[model samples]
Target: MTDIEKKEQYAPYISISRDEWKTLNGALNFSLSDEDISKLNALNEPLNLAEIQEVYFPLSHLLNIHIDFAKKLYEAENGYLNSGRKRSPFIIGIAGSVAAGKSTTARVLQKVLSLWPEKPRVALVTTDGFLYPNKVLEQRSIMNRKGFPESYDTKRLINFLADVKAGKEHLEVPIYSHLEYDIIPNRVQEIHNPDVVIVEGINVLQVNLSEKHQGPQVFVSDFFDYSIYVHANEKNLLEWYISRFKQLQRTAFQNPSSYFHRYATLSEQEAIAIAANIWDLINKPNLIKNILPTRFRANLILEKGSHHFVKGVKLRKV
Candidate 1:
């Protein structure tokens, strides 16, 4: 075990090794094929069937347990109160650093959970859509801090979550285009009362103190029925971030409409330098200042190794 894992092996959580956690799968049949995994993987990240069976199958099983219990609890409460209250969607929040494979995790979980026998309707949403448009960021003079908490329209995000938790139907969420590096105006993704909602973002777990005094502070995580933090060492995170940037330079960045089109012509060394600079200046600072601090607040933590594979799992004790 790493020193960090040793330190975290205390109350409120039970730290389990990867081998041990895989046993918790309890003979659950995994139906996802290799092609499905390839499609679900994020750029430059490798996710295979073994990883899904060993890591995510157990995770999906655990989430199923939680979902079942939550439903029972809601039903019991309604019976006692004699109020016909509809059960709200189970919201799962996933928070991690840039290029930490959070998107893949969310997508895989969404797929696995939706495949259950009951076939729950799973909806996936990223907090990127909650980010203020590029124009707003430039106007606010914080375009450099694009992934930071201040870059998000926190009030709107909170309201959206509130509505989702209230069992509101046919809600429209703003769509963010990574290629264009901005919110697409007049475009929205409609979410209609999903059974499970997976919210992924770098700052989903973040809580800003400045917003507290404004009123009853409702953080983005307030509505999450469960939360996950994808953890990795800074070395691995930096390497993965640069690798993804390089891959995007060859692919998405080459497009004329891409916000990073200028980077498409950069040499190998030039791309590395630029990626490192952006990581150091923007992503790293935000990770340390905002994202990393909220790691322990998560109900579950998936610790990753240098190769982006989950090495261990820390689940919060109920």
Candidate 2:
């Protein structure tokens, strides 16, 4: 590539093509069973051995290297201060548009990171738990604006991260159920003594944690040891979103107790219409305004092509 082309391609980052990324996987020794993929992948998503070998293994190894470097930094800082400090859970924020596969990436990394020689325990948490409950959104007259930044309890979420960073154990975070389509009342998830915490959500990379954020002020991203933003074309995301909606209609939505059960039996055309409307109104707006704007903040980015195959990996320049 010419210098101008190379500069344009990798400005602000060092970009690697899929073929180049694949070669880095040679030293990775790991495999996932079919059952693991079924449990971790999103509805209507496809994840095969080739995808793991070509994309995730190298990615996992890179994260491991980062984690090691962070440990050394922590020790050095403590030494300089002449104080003894406990190692806190390494926090990783995974951000992307809905149906962009951030959840699957977070889960896969959690599993692979656990298997590293360090045997570090990993905990995965979705910021959906930090979303305002349905009643709160309804009262605020933003039920239609659910995925927007204003739809979340930003202060509480920031406090939760603060606690986690302070080395607190057995912290209780609310549980959100996709099946129920809301936060489960009184159902809590405990984060206890994890070596790593993966926080995934549509707004994980929000440049500002709160509306009142001012110059040189603290933001939620301040707590992340590493952040990744998954990227794909807008057309691909819409297709994936609608496709997953159909899959859920056949599965989760069919359950009598599911909040979306009403849409389960709709005809294909009807289902498509509703899904498209939702994308146009809610998901897409939030992506353009809140999520996509934060993409430049991530330490690494995984760019996907058709069928959710990662075609490029960009590591931010130091």
Candidate 3:
């Protein structure tokens, strides 16, 4: 049987093929301009008008319903607490393997959600900000495992989410610079009172951490109102990662101050070889050991086909 025929195999997720999903896009009046699409798409990722019409518009519509429901829930809870309070930001987590297009999904969701009829204020916070500084990683002897769960200051990340979920205003979040590939010391990105916040990272869907002896085990996932996992077939992800590495060589790596500057002068084949090795040795292992294992935890799964087109989406039945 085909995947569609075997939909029952993946319980709790009603599998919807691209064509089936597109059928739900009834007269949704949303179109992003070429410039906007260019800004939102990741390097070597395909995101055009067709994707917005068929995939994202319906996705955004569903989010609008969820956001509205969340608002009402918050109001009821506040009444029970006997404290007059505004609704906290509806936090959404986006996760997937490296180069699986989570960043693009996060950015696109942030933009699309903000444009809804409610015109809510939306914030996008990447967990990259919570990664331990380079010095700290080196001290921990985990520099080679930069993107692993151990590489993050999970406490700080959890604290930030807690604050955001508490409706705290003018909070500070650490800033990460991809060009430098490190956390900038004393630099923070301020989040004001946003109605919705999208938390994007590879590990967002993973369970929270705590010592067994600790009291209550609070996980990062506890703060999420909804979560998305953007995944591609393993083969497609490897190819996309290599393609991104080559593009970075032509672009970002050319900057002398770039963390990957040494790769700028490499021949195309040479760059691909190094990128492939990195994928095989570092990224693939982490994906298998950490990221992919957490996929089932996501409320929504966007499964992409070759060249980054979302071919299917699995929405959790519950």
Best by TM-score: 1
lDDT of 3 at 189: 92
TM-score of each prediction: 0.96, 0.94, 0.94
State each model's CA lDDT, in order. 0.93, 0.87, 0.89
- Name the lDDT value of residue 236 in candidate 1: 97
- What digit string (tens of lDDT, one per residue) describes model 1 on residues 1-318? 888777776568888999999999868896887788888988899888999999999999999899999999999999999999788999999999998999999999998898898999999999999999999999999999999999999999989999898999778899999999999999999998799999999999998788348656678998999999999999999999999999999999999999999999999999999999999999999999999999999999999999999999999998
Model 1 lowest lDDT segment of ten = 210-219
Q: How good is model 1 by TM-score?
A: 0.96
Per-residue lDDT tens digits for candidate 2, residues 1-318, read: 899997777699888998999888649777678987677776677887788778888888888888889899999999999989788889999999999999888888888788787789899989899888999999999989987888888778889998889998878788988888789998889878889999998887786445666656656788999999999989999999999898888999999999999999999999989999999999998988889999989999999998898999998988
lDDT of 3 by residue, 200-269 (tens): 9998877735366467666788899999999888999999999999999999999999999999999989
| lDDT score, candidate 2, position 250 | 90
Ranking by lDDT: 1, 3, 2
